[model samples]
Target: MKKPMRLSTVAFFMILAGVAALGVAWWTQHKLGIMPCELCLWERWPWRVLIVLGVMVPVLPARVGRGVLWLCAPVLLVAEGLAICHVGVEWKWWPSPFPACHAAHVVGRTLAERWASMPLMPSKPCDAPTYLIPGLPVSMAVMGGVFACVVFVTLCVGMVRSKKIRRF
Candidate 1:
């Protein structure tokens, strides 16, 4: 039989994964000059929460720590849902909830006024998807959903196995 992973180990891995994902996104934005859409920025919040949970899980009491680890499953599921929604927006299956996804409106009467009010660099449209791997036909949102699902499953299985071992 395979040995079940410790809760601390699971927590550590979750933190690492969260950081790595954010790092890649940052690299893409800063180094590659690829800007994220409003929805893309929204997708990152859950990962930040997960990183906080990961840190707390290792220091809390055993039962509480395990509970924290279990909490990760739902957090990741929500992240995946957000990513899926973003994918839908990208594919034009539905519209984004954020107004920034649409074109910016200039309320100014004069061209100079409009130019002054406009942002230096406009944000990317949410409907336009960015692929980390060129020609892969997979957008960052799709990849995020996949990663979230994988991590969710891992946390679920780990929690279940931990429970079984505790009962024995």
Candidate 2:
């Protein structure tokens, strides 16, 4: 018989994958000099959820953990979609949000005005790619595709394993 997959083992690998993905994102930003746009940063929130779930599920009971993994499916799918879209936007495949991506300089009349307006304006936009390799045309989002794939694959694997375990 095939060895039963341990919840802890799956969770551990998932967490490790998430961490590695995050590390790659950071490293790509720093080494490649790609700057993240506002939406790019926003998209990361879902990935953060995956990472958290990956670690937390191992601690929960088998039933609860499986449920959590199931829940993670949609979240991972959405995150992947967002990352893919972001990459497309970076490549000009689709129109990005209006007003352009990235922070704009506000010439406020006074220091207080500038401070007050800061709350109203985001530091970055969806159109602007924060980081790009010095010579390469590819943006950070392009590099991030790998991370999305990782999440997608992990979610798929978890689902398959869960089904197999339940059948037994």
Candidate 3:
């Protein structure tokens, strides 16, 4: 007979996945000197939440832990939605919803005045796709979206398939 998937095992892997995703995002920004755009920064929140919530899932009773993990699907969906919005913006299909993503126009006749009008913090245009690898066609946002979809579907399938397990 085939073995059933364990909620605790999935939950443990989930915690690791969240950590790895967040770590890569942070490492790229701090170590690689790649500044995250506003939407990019916003994308990290769901992963952070996942890490926080997934930490206790392994210790909880099976049903309760599965319930908690099930709740994570909606969170992942939210992340997927954000990634889609970003992808649309990057593709010029629609403008970014965040006002900060728009570039500030330097409205001054003098060079010094225009210089003074520049934003204190540098910001990237949300429409530009950020590719991690050189010459790679896929964007980071698209990759994240794909990852979210895979995880969301996996969790849903796992939960539905293993319906009778009682312990964590």
Q: All candidates' TM-scores?
A: 0.93, 0.69, 0.87
Assess the local accuracy of residue 71 in candidate 3 as a C-alpha lDDT between 0 and 100: 82
Give lDDT: candidate 2, residue 87: 72
Clashes of each: 0, 8, 0
The TM-score that candidate 3 achieves is 0.87
Position 79, candidate 2: lDDT? 72
Q: Candidate 2, clashing residue pairs?
A: 34-131, 34-132, 35-130, 35-131, 101-125, 101-127, 101-128, 102-125
Q: lDDT per residue, candidate 2, 61-80, as tens digits? A: 88898788766778767777
Model 2, which residues run further than 4 Å from truth? 29-34, 98-138, 162-168
Give lDDT per model, in order. Answer: 0.88, 0.68, 0.85
Query: Whose TM-score is greatest here?
Result: 1
Task: Order the candidate numbers by TM-score, best to worst.
Answer: 1, 3, 2
Where does candidate 3 clash, by residue pair?
none
Candidate 1 similarity to native, TM-score = 0.93
